[model samples]
Every structure is written in structure tokens, then in C-alpha cells.
Target: MTKTLGRRLFGFGSSGRSAARNPGGATTAADCLRLYDDAAAAGPVDAELAEAAAAVRQLPAADPGMTDALLALGGAALARDLPPLALAAADAVLTRRKGSRAAWHLRGRALEVAGDLAGAVEAFEGYLERTDAASAGAAEVTARIAVLREAHSWRQDVVGALDGTAPGVGALAAGPLPAFEAALGRHLDDRLAAAGPEEAAGLARVVGLHAERRRHQLLPPLADPLQGGTGRLRIGEFRNLVAGRSVCLVANSQTVGGGALGADIDAYDLVVRFTSFRIDPAATGERTDIHVTGHRGALNWDRRVTTRLVFSDRPEDWRQALRTRLVPGAQRFTGDDSLRRPLRTVGGLTPERWPAPLTCGFEMVWLLDFLDVSPRLDLIGFDFFATGHHRLAEAARIAGPSDYSSEKAWVMERAQHVTGPVIALR
Candidate 1:
């Protein structure tokens, strides 16, 4: 990346300085080193950073500290919004040490900032190859790769659509629902072809439901689901409702119905449940503070529920639910379709190649954590889709498109960690 190109893309001027000087009016290697450290920590364009960069350039060709200095300067440059300088520093380190993992990681970040998505992927992959896959660093890089790849694909689609080179790109404009339905159709077809008669019959029902959803788009898209759209409560408003208060999230797993935790669940400050949840007073809670559901299936809205939150990647699906499934006298809320990919980045919980849509239950977990809702958040009846025993018959019969294994692992890991809210698995 050239300085001129960086300036044009990032709208920042280049740092200009001649050399580093001490109070005694003389420059030394120690002073230069200190300046580099200060610049890296400060993370801004200033006389100190410019002087450090100039002094580093004057170092001896084979200086032993050259690589380290360059790495530090690269980080400083990246923090200061100088992608060109960061890129140059990363390149210098790689040239000196071909297998330098830090250099490749730095290059990847700089490329990402410079809007070179492809190059960023290449550099990050290089870093991943050199790092241990079992390490936390590897997990973070894997998540980063997933995000970058999605961004790259979305950017390509946009460009192709603008140039009249991509025909189905318009499907994206409608939201992820169209693409999800197409993928689900293919998945069902492949499974049906290989399944026994009984399994095939169940798969056919799923296909029928999918088709019904498409045929029932009787209304136009709903208003945006973000804060300023429709009757949705602001994120801050929801946060205030739950912050510092005990919260319980009840799932539809059959295992829950076997237990007698209803009173415990209802005792919390708030009780939340997913779509089609059962109401066995002794097993499941009777109170419904919030009801969360997707666009598909029948919405059995409880009369006592105070709020209804709808989640769908497709605006049309949300609109359909609002028109056909919404219950009166309840506060309504929904998430923006655009938040799907970005929300996946929350807690780095998603797998490296998750093409399927997230389940409404999993999204609620992520949202609660993102909002820092409460100190103690209880998870009831969640077996991560294991045993496939849902309260609703159709839900138990058909497997949805979500990656259950990944969601389970993410929740398990979060439960084991100490940083976030205490996610008590019941």
C-alpha cells in the first residue's frame, strides 16, 4: 500500500519528521528504542512517532534490533491509522525472517485496514499455518478468517451486482432468508435421497413447511428492526430492564420437563422462553416475561407475556410474522437483518465456516451477553439440540439449519470462563 493510496483511503496525512534528538541535542539507539516503545503505547501520530520512524530507518543494515524495532513501529503505525507505514514495516520483517508469525499477523491486520480483503486473508492464513491450532490465538484467528471471508464475499457480490455481472445478487438485498431457503432445499433433497422411508417422510414435512413459508409472503417488508424503527425498544431500554437483575432463559428441551424447576425459574426477576415452549407449571415456568421466536412455525403467544421479540435474517419473514403471528397488547422487538454476521463476532462463538443461520435461542444468549444483562443469567432446559426432543412436534421432527455443535461448545466454554456473566446451566 502506497502512502498516497493510504491517505486517500483512510483520509489521514503522512507523519513527517527528520530525526530523533535527546535533551542533550544528540540521538542515540537507546533514545530511539524508548521513542518506539512510547509511540507504540501512545498510539497516535505525533513528533515522537515520526522521529522514531526516521531514526529506525537510519539503523545499521544488519542491526540485531532491526526486526524488533520494525515490529513495534508497525503496531504503532497501525494504531495511528498509517497503513502504509505499517505495511512497510511488516514487509521489512518478513523479508528478514521468512517464517515470522508476528510479521504475517501484522501484515494481515494492516491489509484488512487498507481494504485489501484477499491479501488480508492470505496473510492471516499464513499466520494460522505457523501457529498451534489448539491455542486460543488460533481460535481467534479462525474467527477473524470467518469474518473476513464473509466481508470479502459480500463486497464481491456488491461490486458484481453494480457491474451487472451477478444476477442472483439481488436475493441478498431481500436478506438471508432467500439464500437460507435455497440451501435448506438442497440439504433436504440430499438427505431425502439417502434416507429410509420413515426419515424421508419427516424430511418431506420440513420441505413442505419451507415451501409454505415462501408461499405465505402476503405482506410487504416490515420497518427496520433497529432502535429507531417501529415499536421496538432500544437496546439500552432492554438493558435497563435486565441489568443487575436475575434472569432465566427457558429452552424447549424435553429433559427440562422431567425436572421440577418451575418455581425456581419463575422466582427470577425475569423469565424468557423460546418459540413453542411448553407450560407445565411444575416443570416449566408459568410466567413469560419475554417471548422470542423466528418467522417459521405457529406462534403460540402466551397471554401473560409482556414482550415479544422476533428474530429473522429476512425482512420479509419478520414482516410476515408481524402481520400473521403477532399478539396484541405486547411490546414488539426485532433485530436488524444486517446484524447477523456482525453479531456472530460476539464472543467469537461461531465456527470457522458456519454457513447456516443461527438459532433464535443461541442469538438470545449472545445478545444477553453482549448487553451484559445480569450478574447471574440462568439457562434452563438447554441441551443444545441433543436428543432432538423439542416441546413442539414439528420442531422435534425436523432438524433446523443451525450449527448446534458449535453453539454448544461456545456456551460450554463461556460457562467455564470467568470474564463474562455467570451463565448457570440448569
Candidate 2:
């Protein structure tokens, strides 16, 4: 594992830097240690990281203080995806550096990569506490501690709130539509009262789906219940940040009625990033710029989702196209095409789409505002996540990746809801 660890560092897809660098005229123990420290800060999977990892491995063989370097190298190896090697390297470091924080950090990272988040968190916390207060990367280590804490908090909140429950919008079984409606209405009203009219309308539409699902359980309705998509969708806006000339608002909602029965929830998860905003510096008019996609809900299920919108002095033509054209085109798929293609198209002015690896600092304001006028849908609720572009970008990176699995892919497909790791267990 130790031998292969060096080679594994060579094929990383991202940066190509080493974890450590050799400064001029420095071969002393202090200089070597400092270089290894620099390498860790530079990051693992770097050009010098391999050398640093090797140096650390060898350092402990000669000097005891170099045990810290050995431990750090193990963490670097794991970050570089050389797990077996990382395990061996970390073990080597821990053998001599028994109680050193760097060794523990490496072990923690290795465990984390091995899918032991809890264990990893414990080790990282211990390492942070043991490390010197004035370490070069102390701030970063502190930030990591915060991140782990937040992730833990968020995970707990989600589990406590929704764990062991169904994972779908349909979790509100049809047997209790009246109760569901009452409860849902109260929830919506309480949370969304302060939102704009458009947001309120959009949110109401999402709630309306609950009512519709109660009447027909895979059975046809006696007649088309009111013209479909005719009502205004509700949007429940929550947080709003005042940008220089524009305002960045974060809104979320329980969007029901977007999918038909037996729709997939594991399909590609949709992330709406707000790119830029168009606001009048002179006048206080409201306008924003953004892109939206992932229309094909979950696993290519036919669902109308508005990804992004660009507002203007006149009106957002592209947004209307999404509501009128692209969404309908996606609805036409008869299970033959890939479920994701509907929301993954390009080269059309209608819903002007872009490829994946989406831009950050963008949001779905147009749809959020549009939800206000469209009443047939429900806009559950929105959360104010960040204040500005920097925060927004940070939020985007933290939102994690999407899950796009088909309904047919899991045995629990018929259940009202699904939770915890959306993907099917191996």
C-alpha cells in the first residue's frame, strides 16, 4: 500500500500539485518539517503531496518528531483516493506518534473515506484539539470542524423530522387528505404568510395536489377536474437579501402535482443556482437573472419544473416558454427515452438551457415570482440561506449532489415516502 500510494497520487482529475515543496538551502530537520507542513496546507492530491507523503513516511523511520508528518501524509493519501495506502501510512504514523493529533487526523480522514463519517468526525475533533493553537492551517481546521458540526446538525434535523418516513410527496396517503389538507394548509399559512403574493399562489398549488391525489388513487377521475395548469401556482418566499441594485431572495416550496402517479424520486436532483440579477439602479423595479433546469423530475419522470429565469423590463419570454413549451414536451415522453433527457436539452431559445456543471450565484426568482400568479400548484416554503454572492456560492457547493433514480429501481417504490440514502442499497 505504501509503495502504491505514491503512484495513486499521479492520476487525480483535479489539481496536480505536490503536498510539500523543498525551499532553497534547507535540509535541516526544522526545514523539512516546515516543508511537510506547507504541503498539507497546499492540499492532498497535489504534485508535491506524493513527495511529502513519502518524506513523512521516511521521516519517522529516522526521527520521532517526523511522526506528525507521517500521519499528515496518511490523510493526504486518503484525500487522493489511495485508501489502502492511506491506511498503511496512517498506521505507520500512529505506531510511533501514538498520541499525535496529525496521526489521528489522517486516521479520521481515512475512516471517513471508508464511509465511517461518525468515526471520522471523532478523530478530526480530537486532532483539532490536540494540535498546537498556532498551527498554520488552524483556521482551516476550525472551519472543517464547523462544517462537520453543521452537516451533523442538518443530518440530525432531517432524520429527526423525516426519518423512517416515506420519501415522496405522496407520503401524505390518500386516506387522510382532509387531515393532510388541514395540517398542510396550517403549515403553509404559518410559514408563507410573509411571502409575496406570487410565492403564496405557487405554494397553494403544491398543496392543491394533495387534494387531487385523494380523489384518484391511480384510478381515472370521472372528468378532467377543472382545466389543468389553469390556476396560479403559489410561491412561499422566505429570506430576501438586498444586493446592490437587486435583491436575492431564497424561496422553497412543497411542489406537488409536478409528477404523475408512480413517478421516480431518485432521478437527478434539481439544483437552482441564481447567476446574476438585473435591477434598475435608478428605479426600484424588481428584476433578476438566473438559469433553471432538471425539468425531468427524479428518474426521467414527466414533470414540469422551472429551473431558472431571467426577468426584464418587458417580461421573461423564456420563463413563459418553460411553462408553455419545454415542460409540455417533457410530458410527452412515453417511457422510451432516457428519463433525464427532457430536462437536459440545449441549443433552443425557448427554454434556453445549459449543460451540467451549472453556474452558482443564480436562482429561480422568475419561477418564484411566477408561482404567485399560478394558483393550481403548491409552493411549499423557502429558506433564506445566504446574504450575497459569496454566501450563495458557498451554499451551492454545500447543497451536495442530486439523486436521479427511477421508481422501478427500488422495491419501496409503492411506499408513500422514502428516506435516508435515496439510492438503492448495494
Candidate 3:
């Protein structure tokens, strides 16, 4: 597979310049049309492209139609490996039209080229209903649809056993993605043969976590908040291939709320502590930091939030461990047999603070950027962070997981969703 190109590779593009340059410049609609024509020219008319781009940028915040046109131009630039221009154009469009299908579609394509499959999928799916199969931009829309469908199908198949859609004990027994499954299983079997049972057990924990992550899709936790000894919170795991870090260390956790009042403070605190571990840090002397940002959502609606942390240099051994633990149970694919078994405990710390009536979730992203310094990262390290925001509401409405009463716990429950901002650590 070809890698995503960066802004540097495309010479001087829009991202290279400051947003202030054309803040008060004279860039009109006609100027954007001219800029589009010039960008399509053969040689490096960097100056001309910049001028036109600046002009186009000024238009998006003023007019939606112009914003769409700029997004289209950005797509064109991205197709030519002009990362800087394409991204800037997309950024401009997205800024004004945050939920615009055209903006998201264009950004998705750019992300794909940047080797950000996860981000690309997110953007593409965001515009799913807007892009028609036979529209003027049918090709781009269709391409995105194809990519998302394949990835979605694969994810569903891999996690099918976990969801009780299949009756299997492990991935191999699941019989989904036969070839990929086999390869993963074989690799794990060999590793297990060489590992101590404790290490093997740790590996198993990783595998189980991987599946549970997909089964939840970063939704708020669905468990009794006070069930486990440490007080329960729903957790999801996701791995991202970030390009600028090394080792699988927690980058940071961010939470938003009303001054951390009620159960939110304790809940957010638990997440912060859990995700800040220095996984295998001794072997790779790289410093990993986890920054937690918090915000408050409506207290009555769905109180769900998404937190994404970068895991640099994830170990392949982790993936191997997962394959060993899950593949064997995949064959019987018929029920939640795989999840019915408790996950082996891995080397992680649970926070001491136990918060009540609060929910949150985690997106433990295995950032690809960290792999460069910590080459041990594995394929199983995509993006499987966890969440527990929903747990609080469930706790409020219904009794804890151990409490089997079917009666509602809280009538006027609001969901507080948190979405972590992308923190680029260069």
C-alpha cells in the first residue's frame, strides 16, 4: 500500500502560510475560479496557487456554495499529492461547514492519502447519506463507500464472536476473515510456545480487550458503575497508527464537565490514571504523556464522550497474545462464548477513587507515530479505546450490574458525551 504524502512533499502549499496573510486581502469568487485554473497548470506556480487558495479560503466563511467549490478544489489538489493545499482547502471548508457532507467527503479522501484510515473512515461515514451513487462526485463518494464497507465488514467479522453473533471461543474458531485469521493464529501459537504462562495470560487480556472494543464502538459504558471492586466503568479500545511517537505510552486524557462536579470528577480521574501507564517504557527510553481534557454536556440527554490517547510503539507481542487467546474460539461462531469467559488481567492499574452516578468511555488509540521509536507495535494496535459515560446514567436509572432489578433508576437522564481533541505531538 502507498503511504500518505505530507505537506512538505508538495512544496509550499496553503498549510505553510499563516491564516493571517489574506485576512484582509481581496480574494473574490472570481479569484477562486482563476486559482482553480492555475492550480491545474503543469509547473510549480506556488505563488499563484497560494494567492488563489487564500482567495478561496476567504469565500468559504462567507458563502456555502463557495465553500463546496473550495472543497472540490482541495480534493483535486490532494489527488495530485499536494497535501498542504488539499488539507488547507478541506480545513477551510470544514471550519464553516462542520457537518457538510462535501467537506467531510473531501477531507476523508485527503486523510486516506495521509495514511489515516481510521480518520478517513470516520469522515467518509459522516457523509454517508449525502453522497449519492450517481452524483456529480460519484466517483469519490463511491470510492469512500467501498473503503468504509470493506473496513466495516472486516471489523464486524472480527468482533462477531464477541457480540454473540457467532458461537466460537476464539478468532480461529470464528471462521471469519479465514486467511487473515489463520495468519494471526499461527503467529500467536508460535509466540505462546515460547512464552511463560503469565506472559501468555497477559497476551490473552490484550486479545479480549481488542474484541470488546469493537463490540462497543466507543459508546458510553453499559455496565453497573459500582459492580467491579474498583467501581465499574465501560471501556472501549482503539488503536491508531500515528506517525510521530515511539513506544506504547499513554499520551493524554481529556474530559469536559461542570468543574468536575458530582460523579464526573471521580470518573474522569479514574480514566486519567488508567490510561497514563508507561507500557514497556523501560525498553524504549521515550517519554509518553497523557493529557486529559474534560467538558460538560447536557446532564439529561445521552451523556457520552469520546477520549482518544496516542499509544506510541505498541508491541507486536500484544497482537500475538490476542490471536492466541481469541482465534481458537472463533471456529464455533454461534454465541457470546468468547466474551462469556473473563479476560485475563494484564499489567494495568485501576484508579483508587470510586465515583458514583457518573459514566465515561475511552478510545485507546494505538498511534502509529510511536511505532517508529518503538518498533514492537502490532497490527492489533489499531484504535480500541474504551468509554464509561453511559455507566453513570445506568447507575442513576437502574441498579448496579449486580442488581438485577429491571426497574428504571433515573427517569430524566441526560447523556454527557465527550470527544477528545487531536493533540499532535511532534
lDDT values, one for every candidate: 0.60, 0.35, 0.35
Model 3, 7-120: lDDT tens digits are 323433222233222221343445445434444453454453454455465654466446645654575566566544555566565565566665566666665554344555
List the lowest-lDDT window of 10 residues for candidate 2. 234-243
lDDT of model 2 at position 318: 28
In angstroms, give how far residue 144 of model 2 lies from its true place. 1.0
Q: Could you tell me every candidate's TM-score relative to the true structure?
A: 0.41, 0.25, 0.26
Off by over 4 Å in 2: 1-76, 84-88, 134-136, 165-426
Q: Provide the lowest-lDDT 10-residue window in model 1.
A: 15-24
In the order shown, the candidates' Cα RMSDs to the true structure are 21.4, 28.1, 25.3
Clashes of 1: 0
Model 2 gets an lDDT of: 0.35
Winner on TM-score between 1 and 2 is: 1
Top candidate on TM-score is 1
Model 1 bad stretches (over 4 Å)? 1-230, 330-355, 393-398, 401-403, 416-426
Q: Compared to the true structure, candidate 2 yields what TM-score?
A: 0.25
Clash totals, every prediction: 0, 63, 96
